[model samples]
Target: MNLGCIVGLKEWIVPQDKAFFDLFEQMADTVNEGAVFLNVIINNYVDVQNQCHKMKQIEHQGDLIAHQVYEQLNRTFITPLEPEEISRLATALDDILDYIDGTTQQMYGYGVTETDDFMKELARLILLSTQEVQTAVRLIRKLDDPRAVEQHCIEINRLENLADVVLGNAIKSLFATNDAITIIKLKDIYENLEVATDKCEDVANVLSDIAIRHS
Candidate 1:
């Protein structure tokens, strides 16, 4: 390419690092709100449909942020992080919100009449995992301390493992009973909650990857 073309290309690809970080933080904030809403649903166990409705709003907000990230990536060739890394991080973050919303929907749609102790415990783990996720997301912007981000990731993995144990015990206890329909419904709800933690770990993995590469 000619010098003029090369210069134009360079200008076209200027980094908007702050914009991406802001968008990610907005997304993380929205998801955290969803997690809180979920806890409300679990703890209150009333008007679940309406509660799920409110959580849907947060999920929609997260979708808008994810779309903005994709649009930003399309328009900007130069980013503070690699394009792939940006996409992965955004996708992973979005997935957590999606699963959170999924659990809310399942809890109501599957005709779950009450929240069990297992479900409550799973919700707590999800909230804790998202808090870690939020910290990691913010820390990733600077990557000055890769260890800090990795520490958060480690905690996230530990939470996910705890979720696994919760799921296993939940299923074991569920099968021991004879109420087939209740067992089916609660099992689905429990599994969905556990999967939400799995999504959190996915976010941690992406954050850890970004920190390793960028820091």
Candidate 2:
């Protein structure tokens, strides 16, 4: 059967399944908004905490959609792509939300009140990564043009690397400071941000693999 027929069958049989992509879009929007909020009110710990909590809920919803997609893909054989590929893509998309949620949780748990330049830069990198992820996901349903996917993966990788540098500098600055408690809190936040970046790279890697395999 053709791709359209398969997708049509999926839609007819699985009513909730169609919402997976929409959830991903919501996840991207939440992350983007959270990043902007963090940048704008980095000094307001309470505001940051509230936004993080909101992000956590959004991420959890995204995770639920990913789980539903995974389960549905397992039961259905006539997928648009290999079952393994679909699983990988779903998992990667969920992973982004996981990282975003975890990062926000740490930001609150650490009671981080002040934002440094490095933290601002890290937030910006996260915004860029999520935007790239959104673009990549939009192309996954198309899958005809590997070139666009490749380009997105490249951009995601670059943003992830930039985040890595920011994380390193933040850590260095944390150590350079004499406040032990502050250093500890900031270190935890930095680590969580770094993990989020790594998750973005994971999404890119999955996209790259799909592109290469299908090309």
State which candidate has the highest TM-score: 1
Most accurate candidate by lDDT: 1
At residue 120, what lDDT does model 1 achieve? 89
lDDT of prediction 2: 0.72
| Number of backbone collisions per candidate | 0, 0
TM-score to native of every candidate shown: 0.93, 0.81
Cα lDDT of model 1 by residue, 101-189, tens digit: 99889878987778889988999999999999889899978888999999999999999999999999999999999999988888888
- Backbone collision tally, model 2: 0
Worst ten-residue run, lDDT, model 1?
Answer: 7-16
In model 2, the runs with Cα more than 4 Å from the true position are: 1-45
In candidate 1, stretches whose alpha carbon ends up further than 4 angstroms from where it belongs are 1-11
